[model samples]
Target: MARKKRPEGTRRPNGASSIYYSEKDGKWHGWVTVGVRDDGKPDRRHVKRKREAEVIDAVRGLEQQRDSGKVRKPGRAWTVEKWLRHWVENIAAPSVRETTMVGYRSSVYKHLIPGIGAHRLDKLQPEHLETLYARLQKPREQGGKALKAATVHLAHRTANVAFNEAVRRRRMVENPARVAKAPRVEQEDIIPFTREEARGLIDKAAEIRNGARYVVALSVGLRRGEALGLKWSDYAVKWRHGCPKGSTCRSRDASKCDLREGRGTLTIRRAIQQRTWQHGCDPDGSCGHRLGAYCPHRRDGGVVESEVKSRAGRRVIGLPHPVIESLETHRSHQEIDRERAANLWADEGWIFTNRLGRPVHPTEDHRAWKALLRLADVRDARLHDARHTAATFLLELKVPLPAVMELMGWSNAAIAKRYMHTNEEFVTAIAAEIGGHLWAEEDDTDDDDGPATVRLAI
Candidate 1:
């Protein structure tokens, strides 16, 4: 059938090239030429509406945007799902550590995509994100998982970042996620062990094979990964027997020193992590398997040696006498175990390891910590709380805040402030000091004729 053409001399109302009506399709159509591609083809968009008035209004909006120089040329339509996958694969993967990349992938795939990926990238509104958050707070029985505020916040942040990238790429005029309200994440109270409780825990840890690991955590405030990643060679011990007072000794004797007098410094360089390999197969196609359950190699995921969490996280901490002593003892115990195992020993050179000398897995480390807490009869706390315990102790002892921050390897002063809380004893001592200046003993009065008038000093 021949196409139905518009009547001859049919002119658009405003004489705009973008206004038209399709007689064949019985719908109003508006076309705007946004730009020309390098190949000399016009980059155009066709906006269709059942009503001619709506199509005109849409065309005028695009014309105004073009006049204002804010018009974004239409490209292939992008949904939230497509943009997120692209961003995670291209933008976020290269910059973040392997562990952090895992978190990004998890947040994108598990939560953000499922929640809002159906929306068009340019058409997403703040209300859509608001609805998603509201749904996330509901119970699983009601079609929501009731995720924690932190997890929800993670999803919000992931979307916000991805949308920002979209805007940068000119895919959207603005990021709606910036205006969306996510649930506020409340800070949990820091529960640090008391001095006595810390001692008790350390003593119990001493009975275990990996006691020095706990000592490192409690004494120097190293994070769990930092302590676990420690190598024996990272420890630098200064021996008293090696040198007379202020004299450099060239002696190379190994057995001349008393273990009780050794002091050392431990450098934190790297942290151990087990995460899924971001690059699953060889890019050259040598291996055809994707990284997952069925992959013959790396089935359990990959082990990564990553830099410390922050630049400040890399530090050299001086060990106290007791901690140094404990490490020496722990070293001797490791030697004995190595001799017993002989050819069975793995010899990974890690300070804390399994019976066969393999590095202790993080999960196994947590189990050991729990068992030690039970044995010590102390209230349970996360392994991270040991770092808090150290910080609290330093602050209570009147260590300067700057010194404490440096010792704890904290880049932000606010983090130190948040973690170091004043206990009742410290507050009571402060009160006593204030009271000493504000109050004076009443003069001894012998007269019992009424209660002796207390003198008030202005």
Candidate 2:
């Protein structure tokens, strides 16, 4: 067939838009001017379509995007990997907390990048994200490792946020990730120790060295990190018989005091965490030279203090009498250890520390907790469940919802309510309360006698 040609006097349309047949690949090519470069030259994007009609459609879409001021000028090529790294390092790291940044980096690098990082940032589609989520939900034996819905959700959030930034920077017309679907996370049932089980655990803990730690965890619902981060100064004791005249109340004499008749308060302000240091050591060898040293890294490898998990986590809890007594005994025992170590003792002031006077490792604490559970012959339960036990006990005692929320350091009542589980006994009691009046017998002898008389019709 003969190729159609334009007339010699005819002129091309103005405004930098064109569609022509590309003989090289037997395809039609479309180009549209998006903007000008620094050198004042036209910046154009070339899109190819197999058919001439398709090319026309592509050119029309490009024109619409450009006229609507949604078209972004093409710059350096950006892959999903590059954009994600840049976004996390430049945008997210500075704005979020270190712990949060750690999570973001893990989600971005480990999952997001490996799944779809090679794709062009501007060309990302909703189907790509959908496929990623579907694959993540499959089992490893099926050529896909199943991830928790929560983990997948985190990845979705990271990608969505990054793509949103791309849109804000005009790097792309829209964020495909915004339309992607993620699985919903279900709330896990709270498992707490029964009162008897809790007592057994406490008794077992008492036989151990750091037994007071468990007591505090159960009594006050302090997180493990918060309990480990506690200092002697955070404790305030009100003596039963008031301090004798002007006698200075020293922490060393805590065990000697009659704690059974005293009340105590613990102020939770911080938590202890073992975070990986990006910058390990300074040029000088001055790091970790002394106890409680201000080193970026630990000398003997110890934890560093960090802010509480949330604003609500910072709270003042009134300690139970048993817990107060346990703490007093613990302090006395700690003083004995210090005296034995003499000059070797490191006074880091952490309430729960190793013999070297450094904070206890969470793993070691876990081991001790497990041993205590075994010794007490109690059912297996996570250390965190102690907090749930405390909350459940408070709710069972008819403590007001708001009071329970404050005591548990929860920001909302809904969370506190989740910890309040109704067992069979409690359910039965509630049922009785609802139906008690309905089951009551009524007096009817006098009414029966009066009913024997007949009445005349009016």
Candidate 3:
């Protein structure tokens, strides 16, 4: 039997419109709409049987609203630049290390701002992000060289994280970067220097014009900043004991007072970000004192501050035996120089200072490292490889991961694990032992059947 359709003009308890069903495209549809059209006239849409129940509920809810209604739909409209500024101000500024903040700022300013800063938040689709990623993979201008996949990935990751925060803050409903795909980038296999190679490089360093520069680099994995930041006081090799009044020089008496300088451990407490040489002036013209004009803060005879990299970068590293010895030797020679200068000498206590006792700049340290590498005939490697070398040697010695992490000043295992690559020979040997028994077969020619022996190698 065919069912009869309801006539128009029926009203619900909500009192706005009546429900009705219609057939179109061989399927039923339902909708309820009340609004003005572009012609300034009213418009209506029929509600289908399937959706009539939901429509009725929604209509009733809308009718009950007596307060102000939405003039426009809730949506995201902030630009990438605007959101990034907000993130730095609210999220990143207080949490991360200063050096990390600098890096984040640089990446945002140099790479991302120019790329997508102008795009509206809603307008920044996945395609725009993908295009920016592709451009980063292309050749750069200076060297006509493209960035490594890892570097490109880092940039992408930074941007992606920023946009994700935007989404969480309701600045945007979606993260386009989440949908953008980048190329698979694998971490490079580190080529750790063998004992022989390390010795050879050190030997070659002795032959170079600036041999001490390489000596410092090889001895302590001092990120060029730490090395350049070296001061005489940074190495606390002497300890003064509080002595009782009656203590003799040779006595270890518990009751006697004794304070003496002895062997002490070095603490990497602070680093000098900028240095300048100031000369002492004798009021008399007969003994004139002049300070060097070259200074880190100087900009065309003007002084500028704010050059320090970050607080996290100011960390402590225990001096190894080799570092202690090298520093001691360098200090003994410096004492001789100081004695010779007498009244004319500068009192700057920098260990790696120039003749005027001014600290080396980070750029100069890099130049010195390159020169030393060239003299030693070593292949190109980043200044950071020294740190990798340190961690690698520690792992090779089978040091516990936790201990290594502490020495590296990393509080998290995940950060330390980035340096933890398995030893190839150790892996191969372990794998062979585990699989050896699985492939073992019993001898068929034995006179009597016997239980097979399986050996497990530790």
Query: Which candidate leads in TM-score?
Result: 1
Compose the digit string of candidate 1's lDDT tens values, residues 1-458: 33356689996544244756789989989887665656788766679999888887888877676666566646666888999999999999888777777778888998888988998888899999989887777787746568888888888898888889888877887889899998899988877888889899888888998988998888888888788888898998976654554433335453364422677899999888776633334452236655453444434354546788889888888889889888988999999999999999998788988889887888889999999999999998899989888898898888898888778889999998777878776778778876765685655874766665555442
* Candidate 2: residue pairs that collide: none
Q: In candidate 3, what are the lDDT values of residues 1-458, reduced to their tens digit?
A: 23355578853443245444455533334333345545765443443435555656655543332122321113346678887777876798787645556567766876778888899875688898788878877987787777677766766777788888776654665678788897579867676555455666777765543355555565445555556655667666543445645556446633222444344444444454433333333332223433334332222221112322444344555665455555555666667766777776678776765544556565666676677667667777766776666666677668898777656656577865665555554467568867876665555565475665645443
Work out the TM-score per prediction: 0.76, 0.71, 0.58
Off by over 4 Å in 3: 1-76, 85-106, 136-151, 203-220, 238-263, 272-320, 336-348, 374-380, 420-458
What RMSD, rounded to one decimal, does every model reach?
Answer: 7.8, 8.9, 12.4
Residues 208-271 of candidate 2 have per-residue lDDT tens digits of 9999999888877888888998999899887564346455654435435543266889999889
Q: Return the clash pairs for model 3, or none.
A: 30-48, 31-47, 241-259, 243-257, 243-258, 244-257, 244-258
Clashes of each: 0, 0, 7
Q: lDDT (CA) for every model shown?
A: 0.80, 0.80, 0.59
